[model samples]
Target: MHFQVWLQSIQANGRLKVPESEDVWSLLPSFPLSSFSLSSLSLSSPYLLGIGALASLTVYWLVTRPRPMRPPCDLQAQSVAVEGNPSCRRSALLKDDALLEFYYEDTRTVYDIFKRGLRIAGSGPCLGFRKPGQPYQWIPYTEVAAQAQMLGSGLLAKGCQPNPEQFVGIFAQNRPEWVIAELACYTYSMAVVPLYDTLGLEAMVHIFNLAEISLVFCDREEKASSLMDNKVKGAVPTLSCLVLFGDFSGDLLERGKECGVEVLKLQELMDLGRQNLKDPVPPQPQDLAVVCFTSGTTGKPKGAMITHGNIASNTSSVIKILEGSFVIQQEDVSISYLPLAHMFERMIQVSMFCHGARVGFYQGDISLLMDDIKTLKPTFFPVVPRILNRIYDKILGSVTSPLRRTLLHYAVRRKQAELSSGVVRNNSLWDKLVFNRIQASLGGNLRFILTASAPISPVVLSFLRATLGCLIFEGYGQTECTAGCTFSMPGDWTAGHVGAPLPCTVVKLVDIPEMNYYAKNGEGEICIRGHSVFRGYLRDAERTAEALDSDGWLHSGDVGQWLPNGTLRIIDRKKHIFKLSQGEYIAPEKIENIYMRCFPILQVFVHGDSLQSYLIGIVVPDPEVFADWAKERGFVGSLEELCQNPDVKKAVLEDMRAVGKEAGLKSFEQVRDLYLHPEMFSVANGLLTPTLKSRRVDIRRVFQEQISSMYSKSAP
Candidate 1:
């Protein structure tokens, strides 16, 4: 009998199929059942038979296994959360799959989404971010969209096209006009290229040259007017159209004309989009949505080609992550304060649109962030670590009297205990006696706090977690990844790790023996592969090839390791590591993080190599704390003087040493000598990125003299 014929025979005979078929049927062809004897099959034979059975079972299990998922909350809740918000609606429309429908199925395109929001919001004012003393105005979404259409039409009339490839530059700060200009650009299927507000003219020229941007939208003539006033004829000869967002009068237009640049009021362009809508709204999602510039820390900025699909996917990933954590419902609210030019905040804004969450725009400037939070009573917060750190510092600084400080610490512990239980007390005697106005001041609706951009200090993390009663999640990704990669679960969080890779996102470590830096166990370069990884760098094939390998893994350029619990820990940038003469490499960020944790210091740059036998640091002491400490001690001096004093130096050094011991650093690695400086490194100073990470090379160069003096043996 043949194997196949015998298997059919076994089935006819009503016995087990797999091994029984093999044993009684297939094996009999070799020997014959008539000659077989069961008595010879002993315990060892049974063990071998059992092993065979287990192997078959394993294969069967493998074939039938269920798929993995980090399940999100009820999908229905996400669909309705941003019901009446224009920005939220735009995000949803961008993210929604044609196969899957949301509650508002008709909402499509940025135009349609805003139109629907207008219908839903009815007569309400669509508040824009404002400057202080500027009267608040509500431009309804209907009017806003109409105005955008008019401006888009005006551009088309001015010889701009409805083509999907033409690029328009939106170079301005966050404001209503910025949004309107973007919407107008979308109406004509023109790609809106975002320029950094703080970029110097040289960098601006590079972008304009590369992008071939003809039409530029800026907030005021004060912005573009300054360029005209400076007699800087932009290298962009093709740059024909310039539109000012705010009210621009005669002199500014005359100034622009002198520079040979034609200027139009933002309102005039918006009116054009409206007039052109009589023919048709020409833009669609298939058109490129934006051209966001990459942060040029390593080289000149290259545009990352962002499509509506890219924006939508990233937005969905964020929404799904939030849905998993917050169970965000229809009434949940969020505040948008971060720069829209950056991917981190842009993707979040898109997510808000998709989820139907109410989004409040901050009234211009981050100093008003707390005020905005209180006014909106937002259920969600998306902030960088610097802001969170400042908040933590303020709370810690408020304890004046020694006895009162002791009592406050105990009260915080008690509050943490109450938080551990599900019951929250806003007006309990214990609460009134303790947390009080601080809790009320934060506006109480702050339930979901999302921190990103840079690694947050563990101290700030723990403090917020203990007090806020909100679940704060840290997300990690790059602009190249379109902001969809990994996020720490509010429930399953570990400080310093950026959670597990997001669902459907594959993560791996590439061993870089040349780099010699490894995870704690043995580090490797972190690589991610997924739908979210960018197609490639725009117009830079060589650079794109360097970043993305043949198999489509994006080499993240970040050194990372898996925590024991399988969370991802980003250690430092590959470019950030430097070697001493001894050939020992040091990761500056790790050492800097330790210093930040050990002291109330805001920023520190640790530098030393062949020039010095050991490391020395330039510390930027926290000004707020230092000032208060000085005032309390009846100390009077300039900010610089306070930082240079011998007493202050001794105190800061002790803090550094205490931090070193706690972190268990080796003698050679610890800071041997350090100098305190009054001024903190900031984005405005070119020492930090908008994300609040120190530009290590820039810092090293700025403090080169201070560093050289510190390492000199006779200098002290």
Candidate 2:
């Protein structure tokens, strides 16, 4: 049979349903060409057999092909420190013996970024937040600077010492007051320690005592009351004073007094500062700025001592990357919704300040994040992967009409084609007719959006690019490396890999012998060395030695592969892998990522340990999808009732298995049993980290019985 005849026959039989695109060659293997009957084809047995062999060879070649390792033209590689693989890489933007410490300002510390913002954008809108029935309110840079100075003075008057070891805690969400207190610590030589709710009361007490934190800035009265109660219980001995950011009742103050903790309203502290003003004492380069505790995704939270130089250099790297493509400006605004307690969001906010840009706070509501984004109408959005995932799922679920779905699919293809061809703008016909609504949801002025914290799927990234009508860049970093080591540059069109290392750092991968990942093969554990590396964990020399080497390389526990284009692709975890009873080493995150794509699954926790031969998943079902599923199946029940239905559980498990199979998960990797969790895995539930990454330790604790039962049921 002719080639055209075979192709047409396969197409006619519904075996070839891929969209026509430049990436068709890459998409061809995804279709089930094996289903094409050889008996009906006019070919000899040898010819048919050769066709199968050729197809297999082609697919293998495509799968194993090397990814690009060098950045685009003009940005060439300088050197490779590892043999056989160019595992060691730095941006050509950074020449030998060169680093970006201060790009926009002569900044030696975090306090300097604030000072620079005041110098360049004194009266510009700096920090902003919205009120009910009112537009966003703004605090100018000068006013913010003044408040920070006042707060710094007030702390000194309250007998807090001015030194890097003197930790001042801020236990609050993202707010102007949070920044003010943080900056206030930076103004002096004092270091800031952010407390997260994810780190429960025990961890909080541990951090407070470990760092000897005497005063904590609290935004909520309940938070203050909890701290006082803990203090009264003799859990936290160092607690001496409490400063409230918002309104507080007199009863809480009396309760604080009884606990021997001084309670002062935010304004009272600022007023106290008016009587005892002191000159700003900026920290030295190596002095600690923020002692960011890890969100405890794996185990106990460790305080990563982020120095002034670490953050200052990271901010410069961002500024340097955006200089030629999309420069940071005073008009550029970002909505700070992610936890400021984490290094990633804090880094983003600090970068905005260095550029004299505006930052608007969310209304402390995750559901209303997009509303805040729309209200602020930010020009650039910094977000996390889970948020984008929800948006992706929501957009897909909302496109229920068959005609509109088809159009949406084609529009995505056309826009993706345009994006790949180096055309990115919001005025295309596809944008006006198809994606305008999605764009409008993000305030309609976004020129680009950057997502970090976790890996976002390539499909979702492309969809965001096409629909958002803006550049979408993925960044990779950890709290250990001051939040960002590599960022997908502004011009790179393809996804999957987080782009090349930022100019501030040099990145290399070391061999993980047991995992079969080697630097010689262009894949291993990512290691970073430069000014941005943290200044060791607070009072934990043993773990700090493990994290940072004598040569100053920070060993990031994430496994990465170097692309041919110099971008880094996160492949697996250097930690978090569990060996099964059958000797299969399972990366639960890889399997979880696959199951998370299912329509009915909002979040999935895949668990398998040395004792279990097979995997079991605890799935948080999408509420809307779960209800729709029950309604379609003629069931009448609440979410909790539906979760207990055997048929519903079986259906969801099948869906997960199908998704895993489609994603090419190995047999051992595929989950055998599933428990439909009616409630989402959230920080409040003690099942997830603040950043939304699953706390495996916590999940295992919460579902210990369910997990054991699943293993028993799955035993053949």
Candidate 3:
């Protein structure tokens, strides 16, 4: 018999009989027990009838039935979505008047852009950091949005009312929990105040006192426990809640309870929201969304009250400048590794979401960035100078053999030649042989990179561009201006200069007295005015009035000048300029730039004024570069010896002189003295700010004795 007819003959009721051959069973259609019952009953045996009747009943019961019901609602059902928001659209995010006229004439609402991100990143792989010691896990955005809503509802259910200006503190690192907390606040119309994770106990107390944070979402047990174990002198006395993101099997919760605080895990909070609440009220565009802290480089740190309008406006500006620069589309991916407390990464996050790009957070240990990047293969990246320097160090480290070294040098020259000839694509055999490996080491699909914070070395910039066969767009901005001010265009790039101001920005150069290195006529401190300019520092009217003057021009405190072609070259910080005893004004950044080119150090901060005719610097040595140097020289001991050795200092000083001669700098401006520290100066050490800018006051105070001893001869 044919396979279909044979299978029908064996059908016992609504199910098929066991076939003798596996292959034959695969080819047969599903069997019905009713057919089998009819066939068997006609087959002349009462014994056969009994077996067939039992099989038919079993098939009928199994095929169509419902399981027992337990409760009125499933706990999992709280994560459901009520779709179709008319207020949220991608077009509403674009608010720059000039940019709207130029590119993106259509506008998108904040909610619309967020929903688009939801649609674009739907069910895709995304990694996020929760805290230290905890593994960074991957989850879909659809799940993240659901969890965020549930958490928002939970906050409302816990007697936390979301007023238009209600402030909640997000005191954590660049983790997925931080993002969720911020989004949850937006859903509930509560403004999130992002505090730096590296802040000390004093700064934390001060900020809590100022912002009046009733509740805080922190990353680990340490931060949460610290807040609860002790009484802060001037902190928010009514602060009663601490929600930890990860495993809190320590004394943190008990300590919190002792201080009249309620401690809970992030998961517990979300479960509560899901169980008690149905839906959350989303924030409007005009709502006070976030309060970002400005870098206190010149004075005390102040909260910059940012509305949704501000965020939407800045993200729109970013979209305008980056429209055709790179190939990021709705399908591309980006990796965010920088701290979210800073405005730079936060703005990039919003922009990436609006662009319908998937974002993956880097593993907490940034030393493993290469592994993470290789895994994610992001198309969009924004990195600081320190990261780029490491990349340069890695590439140079691979050149060991003579033949390999020569081949690498030859490839670089050829790549530069192709770039000069307007051939940016790496389509040649030599490029494949040499540069392709280099690109692969950076996860291979890197289309564009944005570098900011501290200035990047030109060699690093050129090497990245030629090797990646992609663009590296350099941008300049500050927290006061909400992250981005001006960026280099794809076709218009000039090294050492951070391109022209943005389309909406009006930049003017106010000529000051001639400095040692700045141009006598053309250069001056750069002043900017635009919509992106912040309202004022929160609650400090005097300082705010000083920063934003009578004419609405925000004094950027950065010295720069516009070239005849309209390109702006930032010289240095205005506060960094100091006059020597001989009355020669010197910009320390100019001296440091020359010194960095001379030494293999990560950074050089120059300081000298009243005492000496020249400059001195506190140098932070690169560990990898020095380690290889020590290995090559047969020197042994520790990394500290390599940094603080007199021989290393002499060699570095010789290179400094050579660099001074090459740059044609005056003798007085050359670095006359240097003190090498074994430790790296970072934001964690209170030396550098979160954005990588040098905290001049703190650094100067820390190295005062060393600096005084170095310049004692000239003090008289």
- Number of the top candidate by lDDT? 2
Descending-TM-score candidate ranking: 2, 3, 1
The lowest-lDDT stretch of 10 consecutive residues in candidate 2 is: 69-78
Q: What does candidate 2's lDDT look like per residue over 416-485, in tens digits?
A: 8877766777787888999999989889999868899888888889988889988788889999999899
Off by over 4 Å in 3: 1-112, 123-137, 230-234, 276-280, 284-286, 295-299, 325-327, 514-521, 627-639, 642-647, 713-716
After aligning candidate 3 to the native by TM-score, how far in Å is the CA of 386 from where it should be?
1.8
TM-score of candidate 1 to 2 decimals: 0.78
Candidate 1 Cα errors over 4 Å, as ranges:
1-127, 130-137, 227-234, 278-287, 324-332, 414-433, 515-522, 627-638, 713-716
The TM-score values for the models, in the order shown, are 0.78, 0.87, 0.80
Write the number of the candidate with greater TM-score, choosing between 1 and 3. Answer: 3
lDDT of 2: 0.83
Whole-model Cα lDDT per candidate? 0.66, 0.83, 0.68
Candidate 3 versus truth, CA RMSD in Å, comes to 18.0
